[model samples]
Target: MNRRDNAPGASADIGAALYGLATRAARRLPRDMSLTSAATLATLDRTGPRRITDLAAVEGITQPAMTTLVRVMEKSGLVERRGDASDKRVTLVCLTEAGASYVRTRRQAGVHAFERLISELTGDEVEALVAALPALKHLADLESQDREGQNQ
Candidate 1:
């Protein structure tokens, strides 16, 4: 809405600021698992069961690495591999009840963290963030769409 918003480097500035905020916030949170494991769990929670290879592609990791991670998760009872109902030859990894619980707990923790941080902001700052939420959510939707397109 401001004149400077359309200036060169504005988008990058916004991106960097957002990334820095997220990185710092993430560092302050407890880490129960590696980011890859967390992301894999989130992916399953978001998009349902996925082939190991598809997960690997989505996470930008090697299939064998994904397999090892899946095996560990399975052993820990976080995830289970099941035969694809439509294709018996393929396997899909899905979240177990424990995994779903973990995802919900983790998401709640993130919400709490953000809420605490937001509580410290001035009234105007809080209003700005509240107003920006729809745009932020739209950004996330765009990214999700792009990722889904890639997977397809």
Candidate 2:
């Protein structure tokens, strides 16, 4: 049997293809917004309010850097810093209504672009992809868990 039949290489090739597709799709987004800022807003919108320290941890950035990012985002009306009701000293970062809308808009654009890209695929290929969605979600969860473990 030839080495070309190896499963690991095929899996790596699939991963690289997916990564390239995602990178290209991300490039289609608005140039005015940094990917980090967009990601932060989307995270806040999806997860609700979080402390600045926690947000920094989630975003894998330094606390001071996250502070600067929050300040800029706040000025752009994409995020708001509000004092926690239980502890007035603690500030919680939450997405503004406009931020939530912006996230939704960006998500829609990504979906549209992905759909258009896959429009040429055969029905069987589409069905295979749909069937793989659950496994893909599980893989994502596993990856997130690994990252959290490493952080701790």
Candidate 3:
């Protein structure tokens, strides 16, 4: 019998466990900005500049909501709107130096937090996590591809 078939609720259990870990980890981060705002900055950092509509779609928010977010981020000097070189009518939101710095700092903080947490695990337990890294990364890649497909 397939192992998956043998475990009817294994997937759900794993999802719940992962969600719990994520929730707890997120709480360790600074709450200066909304999750959406941080996500927006991360997107810009990864994909360079993007239109507000694209950002909204990627973040699963409305264009108007993204426009408002852009406004706020712009005011905070984390992002700036610029005319698209190829399409002057379209505006792209780009991350400022400060925004990139914030992303880096936040990422480092998260890494440090996880490092401390991981250090508490037994050697075998840590090995289990290390073994699971590929699968976890693949899951993330799948989700990213799904989001990209939806936007397209």
TM-score of candidate 2 versus the correct structure, residues matched by position = 0.85
Which ten-residue region of model 2 has the weakest summed lDDT?
A: 143-152
**Candidate 3 collision pairs:** none
What TM-score does structure 3 among the candidates reach?
A: 0.92
Model 1: weakest 10-residue lDDT segment is 25-34
Cα lDDT over the full model 1? 0.92
lDDT accuracy of residue 72 in candidate 3: 98
Top candidate on TM-score is: 3
Error of 3 at 147 (Å): 1.8
Reference-based lDDT, each prediction? 0.92, 0.86, 0.94
lDDT of 1 by residue, 36-109 (tens): 99889999999999999999999989999999999999999999999998999999999999999998998899
CA RMSD per model (angstroms): 2.3, 3.5, 1.6
Native RMSD of candidate 1 (Å): 2.3
Per-residue lDDT for 1-152 in model 2, tens only?
86657675876887898799779888889877888889788779767998878778877899999999999999999899899999999999989999999999999988888799679899999999999899789877887787657655
Ranking by TM-score: 3, 1, 2
Which 10 successive residues of model 3 have the least lDDT summed? 1-10
